[model samples]
Each structure stands twice: as C-alpha cells, then as structure tokens.
Target: MAWQTYDPTIEDAYRKQLIVDDRMCFVEVIDTAGQEEYATLRDQWVREGQGFILVYSIASRATFERLEVFRQAMLKVKRQKPVFMLVGNKRDKQYEREVSTAEGAAKAREFNCQFLETSAKTSENVEHLFKTLVRLLRATKQQEQGVQGPIRSPEKEKKGRKCIIM
Candidate 1:
C-alpha cells in the first residue's frame, strides 16, 4: 500500500480521483464546516465499499469537535460497510496541542475504530498510520467472512451455487 495526499483546494476533483486498493490512501484536507456535502460524499463512498480515515488536527479543539459531527454524518449513510480510522494529525506540535493523544484514542475507541497520531511535516508516524489502517481493513474483511464459509465471487454467484472458500 502506498500513501498519497489529497489536495484541499479542489474538492470534487480530488475526491473523484480517490481509489480503493489493498493499500492505504492518505487524504489531507481541512475540516468541513457543513455536513450536507460531506454526507453525500460519505454515502457515495459507502456505496462504493471504500474505507475512510477521518483526520483532525490535534492543535485545534474546533477541529476535534467537528470530527464528532463528521462521524455522525457518516453514520447517516450506515456504518457496517465502510470501515473508518480516526487520525489525530499534527502530532509533532505536541506543545500546541489542544487535544491529548489519550483523548483522541478514547474517542476512537468509543466509536469502534482505530486511532493514531501523525505528522505530515516531520513525517512522524505518517507511514505507520496508513499502514495500520490498511492492515486493519484487511483483517476486518477477513473476519467478516467467518471461520468456515464458502467464498463466492459476486459476479459468479448469479448463475448458480458457485462458491469457493479460501
């Protein structure tokens, strides 16, 4: 899995370029002020079976608060399909942090998602964050299939009982 940052200036264009792969994709953007647009995008991603990483700046309490609202908006689209990770960005600015690492981890736990601190500027834990997310997503997908079950391709199952367990 490779990491790629998303441009904040162009909204729709950047989002349209996002692709879901076996790798983690890092998207960098400022917090959204309203829920309407985000909700629509969340729904579209959910329909496409793409996972997401909700990032908040540890230096800003306002951004942290907005993350709660973002989580709520995502729930409106349903929670089971698209997995999520709560990332506390700008971790290198520990002195200026308004939100503690423990607080962010607690919130992520409460929401049943993974949490991590990363700094893009210094590249501190930047690689670790995305790698962890990709690992978690793969593990979650495997767990969803159960211990013993036939693995069936969606396309092939339409014709008959063509199931293959891995």
Candidate 2:
C-alpha cells in the first residue's frame, strides 16, 4: 500500500483508476510541502501496523534529503510499527541523473530500508516495487504472529525503562 499526494488533478485520478482496476488500495495523497499533514497520515498508518514505501525523484536531491527527516519522525512517533522502503523514482532519467544509484542505495542501507530505482514514466519495475512491499509486509506479519506466543505486553515490556517518551 503506497500513498502519494491525493490531488485528483495530478496523480490522484490515475491512482484512483488503478484502484478501480484492482491495482491498489490504501492510497494516500499529500501536499508536497505539507510535512505535518503527511506526518499525521504516516502516524495513523503506522499505528495500524501498515507498511509504506516513500518515493522520491533521483533527480531531486532535496526530496532525497527530506526522506531522512521523515524516517526520523516515523521512528520517534510510531516507534516500531510500520516498515518502509525508499524508492528512487524516474530512474530512466539516467542521462540527467543528479543522484547516483549507489548513493540512493547507500541511503536506504543507512536507514535499514529497502531501495530500488524505478521509472513510473516507463512503467519500469513499478509493479514489482508495490508487489515486493506487499510480499514483505505479509511475510513480516506472519513472522510477528508466529512470535506472538507468551510475549510481554507493552506496559510490562517498559517496566524497566527510566524515561518514557511518546
């Protein structure tokens, strides 16, 4: 489940079309600069234990940098609920690339998240990106369920903590 800006004028209509065609669900559209609003949406999804993929243009260094701050906020708010992947979109723009593939991959690795270069324009690996996220989420859910027997509750798990921040 990936969420992008909800602008019906931009990609929203196309996203809705994809939903109608049974391509996706749980789509989120956000303002490009609305970090607060985006944070709220992300927190909500995280609380529901939903995973997400964050997309950025490899041609835009600023967007790439913003991903780090977003990741930090997610860690601060949701703690450990939702997992994420960092995607380098518009990979077909190799001739005009501003960020190298290795750099993108390194950033993802630093954040302990999956990384992939894709070109939505060319429809290159777009399907695979979403499919991989779904598969990983399912597998993670299964693993969590398998390990849920006789685990300590959140309260009990935090008993020894000297300081609690939420």
Most lDDT-accurate candidate: 1
Q: What is the TM-score of each candidate against the true structure?
A: 0.67, 0.66
Clashing pairs in 1: none
Q: List the residue pairs that clash in candidate 2.
A: 3-28, 4-29, 5-29, 5-30, 6-29
Give candidate 1 misplaced runs (Cα > 4 Å). Answer: 1-39, 79-81, 147-166
Candidate 1, residue 105: how far the Cα is off, in Å: 1.4
Task: Please give, for residues 66-156, the per-residue lDDT of candidate 1 as tens digits.
Answer: 8877667666776565577888888778899999999999999988888988876666776666556556665765777686454567775
Per-residue C-alpha lDDT of model 2 across residues 34-106, encoded as one tens digit per residue = 2464566556645544555677788888888788777676677775666677889888788878888899989
Question: Per-residue error at 60 for model 1, in Å?
Answer: 0.4
CA shift at 34, candidate 2, in angstroms? 5.9
Candidate 2 accuracy as TM-score:
0.66
Kindly give the number of clashing pairs for every candidate.
0, 5
